[model samples]
Target: MNKLLSYISLSAIVLLTAGCSDDEPKSEHKGLTGYVIEANYEKKALLVAESDKTAKVGNYDAEWYSLNDDAILHDSKNNTVLLTDIEVGSEVETWSTSRSFESYPSKTDLSKLVVADDVKHPDSPMLQKKAIQAALSHAKSISDTAAILIVQNVTTSKSEWIIQVFNSYSEKSYEFTVNAVTGEVKQIK
Candidate 1:
C-alpha cells in the first residue's frame, strides 16, 4: 500500500510540473502590446530612450515624449530646446510601430508653436528678433492667414503659397486652397 501511495504522489508532481512549464513558455513567446518607452525630443525630432525606437506618431495613441539623448530640437525659426535628460538606461513612454521606430516629434502641436515669431530660434536673440520682425513684417499677410485660422497646413511652392484651409461652410470640414505667399489670398468660390 505504501508503495502505491508513493507512486501516486510522484505522478501528481510530474503532472503539475509539466503544466506549469507549458504555460510559462507560451507567455514568453507572446508579444507585448501598447507599450510606450520614454523618449527625448531632439533636432526637431524625438530621440527615444535606450532602444533605437525613437518617438514618433503612432496610429493609435498620442502623448508627450521626453528626450534622453543629448540630441535637441530646433524650430522652423531655428529655436533650440533641450529634449531629454533622463538618466542612462531609464526609459519613458514613446511611440513606435511594430515594424519601425522613429526619433522625431510628430507634427501634432505645430499650430501652437506657430506665432507671430519664434523666440526660441537658434540664432542670437537679436537675430531671432530680426527674423520675427520679418515674419511679422507682412502685417496684412499674417492677418489674412489668421482670418483663415482653420487652415490644415501651409505649403510654399517657389514664389507661390499653397495654403490648405478648412472650409466650414458646410457641416463637414473640407480642405480648400489659398495663395498666401504672394500676399494674394484666393478662396474657392
Candidate 2:
C-alpha cells in the first residue's frame, strides 16, 4: 500500500509540472526595465532608475503610479524591478541588468544641509580624518553609538585637544567630549 501511495504522489507531481506554463515571460514588467538605482524617500519617488541606456545613475522614463497609489517600477536591462526589497549593500541580478554595487545613502547639497550651530571644521583633512576615526572608535567601544555625533574640535585651557560628540539620533542630544590628542572620551552632556 505504501509503494502504491508513493507512485500516486509522484504521478501527481509530474502532472502538475507538465500543466504549468513554460512559455510565460520571465519578468513581471510589461514596459521599462532597470534595477532601482536610487530611491528618494523624501520625494516620494525614485531618484534614479538604472538602465543599460545610461551608464551613470540618471533620470529615466519609467512607469510611475500605475496602481491605486503612486508607485514606481523600472526595467534595468529588460526585466521589472522593485527597490524596497533590495538590500542597501548587496549586488542584484535581474533578468535584464546586473547591479555592481550596493545602494548607498542619498546625496545632499552641502549648501542646503543645516550644519549644527556649534560644528567646527577641522584645520586640515589629516586632522579631520584623525578626529573622525577617533570619534568613531570611541563610539564603537561605548556600545551606545546611536546616541553620538562627531562634532567640532575642542581645545581646553589646559591645552588638551578635545572633540565634541553629540547624540542627536536619540531622544535627546547628549554630548561627549573626546580628547583629540589622546583619544580620551569624557561624557560632558
Candidate 3:
C-alpha cells in the first residue's frame, strides 16, 4: 500500500513538473516579410514595402526599420552579410521591436533581418562593382588613397548609381553617377 502511494505521488509530481517544464516549445513569432525599396548603408536603415498585406504591430504600421546596433543580417543561405550585400530589390524578412513611432514610413528597431531572395537589380553588387571600379579609377587621378563613402541607387528620370569617393588627405571629394543598367560612368563631379 505504501509503494502504491509512493508510485501515485511520484507520478503526480512527474506530471506536474512536465506540465510546467521550461523546455516546452514556445510559439514562434513569424517576422514581417517585405521588399527592400531602399537601403541606406550610411544610416544602417532599410525602407521596406509590404510584400503582400499591410503589417501592423501594436499601434504602429511597419514601413521602414533601422538596424539596431546588435541586429544581425543574414543572406538567403543563412550566411551573415553586411548592409551593402543587401540590394534594393531584395526580398527580406525582419523582426523588430514591439513599439514603433507613428510616422510616414513608420520606423522600428530591427532585431534581425534576413534576405529571402536577392533579385538581380541594377544596384546589386555585380552591377555596383562595375560602377565602383569606374569611380575608383577616376578617384585615383585625384588621390591614390581615395576611399568610397557612399554607394547608393538614385532614381529620378533615370535610375543611376551614385558613388561618392573621398580623399581625406587632400580634402577632396568626387561624386560619380553611373548608368545603372549599363554600368557606365555617366558623370563625375
Enumerate clash totals for all models, in the order shown.
23, 9, 0
Error of 2 at 78 (Å): 43
Per-model TM values vs. the true structure: 0.22, 0.27, 0.44
The sequence of per-residue lDDT tens digits that candidate 1 reaches over residues 67-173 is: 22332334345565333422211222332222222422122211111112322323222222222222223322434332211222333443434433222222122
Worst 10 residues of 3 by lDDT: 148-157
> Candidate 2 — which residues are off by over 4 angstroms?
1-105, 108-128, 143-156
Q: Pick the candidate with the highest lDDT.
A: 3
Two-way TM-score contest, 2 vs 3, winner: 3
Give per-residue CA lDDT, model 2, range 1-189, as digits (tens). 999999999999998987896855433322223322233444433322223343233233322211213233333343444445332111222222212232222221111111112223343222333444455456546655443232323344232335443333442333455454565656565
Better of 1 and 2 by lDDT: 2
Error of 1 at 158 (Å): 5.1
Model 3 C-alpha lDDT per residue in residues 65-88, reported as the tens digit of each score: 788787889987889998888776
Query: In model 3, how large is the Cα lDDT of residue 176?
Result: 75
Q: Give the TM-score (vs. native) of candidate 2.
A: 0.27
The global Cα lDDT (0 to 1) of model 3 is 0.61
- The total number of steric clashes, by the backbone 3 Å criterion, in model 3 comes to 0
